[model samples]
Target: MTSYNAQEHHLTSTTCLPKPGVLIIVVEDDTDTAHLYQTILATRYHHVAVCHSGSEAVARLVSHQGPAVVVLDYHLPDMTGIEVMATCRDLEHPVACMMVSADRLNDQEAGCGEAIRLTKPLGCQTLLQWTAKLVHKVQTAVHGEGPGDHAPENLLIGQSAAMQHLRTLIPRLAQSRSPLWLHGESGTGKELAARSVHYCSPRSSGPFVAVNCAAFPEALIESMLFGHVKGAFSGATRDHKGFFEAADQGTLFLDEVGDMPLPFQAKLLRALQTGTITPVGSTRDVRVDCRVITACHRDLAQSVREGAFREDLYYRLNVLSLALPPLRERQGDALMLADHLLESLAREERIAVCPLDEEARNWIQQHDWPGNVRELENRLRRALLLCDGKAITVNNLMLNDDERLTSAPPPSQAPSGVGIHFSPGRMTLRQIEDAAIEATLEACDGCIERAARQLGVAASTLHRRRRRQAA
Candidate 1:
């Protein structure tokens, strides 16, 4: 669960924020999720009321009189989110509606008239982004003024075919309410990708609670995941809601799921299957409405086959899967992300934006980013503190000699397995290209995006080449 730590910097709202008397109605079925929204939005919009059901929301909106914004959950106990919006639309007073759903809701799917639709597991930033937009729009309509120009919007930046495809798939993935498994190497953006999917889906207005399974010890995993009644354990002084309850009607991202203890995996599986969790020291089960997204760096299938992981649990958890491409496989993306991180880090440190020198850029491009985006960010963070605020040079990067040797091939000689054999007047350019494509494609498990990136060619170009060859 995220805390409202930012004192007054409500960047998600207007410059004149925490708009007093600007009533905002939040319609959610889950108490925790409703409260989470209320807590975060309350920072910017002073009067934030949370309604537990569609009927309750309708009742409140009809009786309520003032300029207001509605954050409606798509799925509710009484009626669909659209029904609540329809009710708000018919009211004597007008209210701007922001509908939140678990799935990706297109205009046709979002039949709530003109409501702003967002997907579940919404972070504070995304919520603020949309709310600020809605608030500005309402203010403009009511007072005949435009929302002032703001800084650029943050987006997942990359031109790799893999990343492009991932961007296109996020909306579709966000729309799905099924359990999703994200498997990748360490430093690949599994959680980031999951967050993107969550924010883009219909549930974007709800809280996104992430739990690192590996972070906690095995002895207390259950108590941590499921709430504990007062006096339930050694440290239990009061009743505590666990991660499941906190993420109700939102998303629960379980990172390093493979690390979860085997014995406890059964209990977790039961909760997922039944859609209910029984708190420690309590007999009654509580119903939870949360989307589960699990990620790991291990081979779960191999674990399952070896009996280290339960097959039933694996099947249940792997409803949908997304394999993240490693940074090493994505050509030029490491440097692209490095540049993006440079500006962000500089801004965060309250210093002038630093530009990467030619040497630094070359080094970044050539170095195999084994740690991926996370590693890149960490390196830039160190560089930010070390550099002289003007330009980041090669010395500031401090790359190792061994990494350079492995990443950069001998200048006169081409790397092996790229399909380029330096033979005396033997191979044609077409032959070399074909070999390189074939080798790279094989290395990437037949993924065209990964292959195209490594070869410094567009995926479409590779596709055309393949088609021409086939013909």
Candidate 2:
């Protein structure tokens, strides 16, 4: 391998021209492609090198003296792209590489580099954009600025009392090493809460691994959690590290924990108590230290009573528990979250920002939101993609007034036997609309023309309004 001296490669002077200190090594066997890349990078960066094989790339990486970024092709003449990355890793050099390939292959195993798959005729603009991003990322890392420094703002957005309460508890939760058990209906931001805890904790520098217990097959749940050794069972070709071991010194989020098999729960309990795990078909125990965070839509307490869950394991995971209130109970948070989702979608899709109409806002508040935050997100995403105007109407959300009316208790059945008693302080505008629509429909015997006349509006206008309300 070719190696360069670092001391001799230092920048000697600073002038108006771009510094030639940043070294870029390109590994492309295709002569035309290599020349094209060299020309493209020459326009912006000053230092660039091209190698035709993985062997040559590895040699240059070991010998390089200054800061360098490597752009490697997935297919190399001497070895695979991943093999070249392994060589750079073995040398212990701080080289950031981007893997360029036309095939959908695993780039992670090849080395720690960004993976960009392009067709035979790659666009120059796309190539430059990827190169710029990779270079900037390497520069940031070299400056000792971690990835967390550039984390997106407002990861959890809301100002409702429930949200404010959660905000206050997150930092405190992060300080503790105990396993956190999160309970809430699906789509209520349980995953977001888990992420907040990880990002704010002392182990923020470490990896955050997430697994969904419900998604795993019942027969494979144990192997997935504790891992398996080579030949441990059928299809066990190689030894593997489980989530517990993978998340060492970091956070392991177990979503849908209630769905884990009862037998696996017993094994997990032992691991939690002893801080050790034994892979399948292995007698030796491996010690692991990781923060466990579990979430579930079902009530664990109920599951324990019914014998579907292990009582001992439940207690261990419940050491630090946080219950996320349903979206309907979060009051004004629905609107705030909707606005945030809409803005985010707009930015990501490069579309114009679409505001929710008053009627639509009312519909959002009135709905029960059985799917919680997830349902709201899906609705907004669909509206953004499907809406034709500047404002997202109730119709765009695909909700009906009847569904909203059915979710609320009848006004006459209020606790005081007079006015309705909607939770979270008072009834929202959506609730009011629901009530009005219900009463009007009853008065007009569901006659569209009669209802319009009774409500003092044009028939066509009322029909459109009704459709919007129903949606």
Candidate 3:
């Protein structure tokens, strides 16, 4: 395998000055694809190199002088992408890797490494975005600008009295070995609180493995968390280390733990109580020394009372608890967070920060943010993408008439009509309109005439749209 250097081969255009002090290595057996990646990266970086095989990549990375980012293809001729990244651990220097593959790999297939995974047929914009993100992360961590003494305050991102108390409680809570329960509404940054606790604790040097309990299916929860030995089940081709094993000597954050299935709760509690987990199909138990942090938006106590959750697991996790305040409860912090998020979003997107206009500011302050910080962030990001003006206004945020009419909080008392429910930014404009029309029709008991009347559209127009949707 041969390697081409950007500086020696004049791969970069003379007009563009590459960013300093970073090297990018692209590993792809396909010559055309390798050159394409090298050319694209050379636009923003000075040191760009290409290697055709995994063996060549491993050789170059092991002896690389400074910080480097590797763009690796999954199916290499000599070895796989995960095998190549596994070698980086033995390197004397720092390295960040991005694994690109046409086939989506499962958690077991991806391995426990921190390499960012990207599916094939990748867009140019996505490639640049992830590369820039990885570069920033590696640089910050290497330069000591990462988690430090002020990690809690820097990470949690609020200064309200409630926020202050939460930050103060985090360090103290981190000193213990108890399981932490973070209670809050959706988008209140429960996972952020858990991270703050992990960074402040003695296990800061170790891994912080976070898994959403609700994201796992009932059949997979046990194996996904406690691990599995090869031949344990169908598709279990090789031994796999789960979240518990991966988080050894660190923090294991279980977000939305209230959604964990009742059957699996007993297993989780046993692991927590005994500090030993038995992988599926294995007779032996492996001991773990990680702290567990659990968070839920809903009330676990209520779930227990309703028989949806276990009382024993509830008591086991609630030993040390923290209540995260919703954004609406934190006075005068919305504007501050808006400014912070706006700047952060701009920097990540590599765009100029769009200042919030007066009307937008007023709406932000007055409107009750039911979705909390997540909503604000989504709105700001959407506004940045949609805004073409000098400043971000309420209209740019799509908050004025559109959201207030269709997506606003429901009235205090229902009028025996259907309440349309959907998450913002998750649906396209066409989808949202379709949902609104369907809900209005449902509320009108399938009377298209009344639905069209309420939807402010002519009956003929509604019929035409419906016909188009069906076809």
Give lDDT: candidate 1, residue 267: 90
* Residue 341 lDDT, candidate 2, scale 0-100: 92
Query: Model 3, which residues run further than 4 Å from truth?
Result: 1-145, 399-401, 404-471
Q: How badly does each model clash, as a count of residue pairs?
A: 13, 9, 0
Q: What does candidate 1's lDDT look like per residue over 1-471, in tens digits? A: 444446444454555564464578888878788888888887777778887755455544533444578888988765677766654543323368888887899887686236777788777777777787777655544553222211011355678888787777777888889998998899797777777767776776676666667655476567667877878765455666777786777788888888888998899999999999998889999999999999988899999998888899999999998888887667668777887898767754567878889867766765556687878887788778778776887667764664334343344433246544556589888877777777777766666644554676656567768888889
Each candidate structure's TM-score, on Cα atoms with residue i matched to residue i, is 0.57, 0.58, 0.61
Runs in model 2 with CA error above 4 Å?
1-153, 399-471
Look at candidate 3 and give me any clashing residue pairs. none
Candidate 3 per-residue lDDT, tens place, 257-348, comes to: 88898888899999999999998889999999999999988988999999999999999999999999988778778899999999877865
The best-first sequence of candidates by TM-score reads 3, 2, 1
Among the numbered candidates, top TM-score falls to 3
Strongest candidate by lDDT = 3
Model 2 scores worst on lDDT over the 10 consecutive residues at 1-10
Selected candidate, larger TM-score, 1 vs 3? 3
CA lDDT of each prediction against the hidden true structure? 0.72, 0.70, 0.76
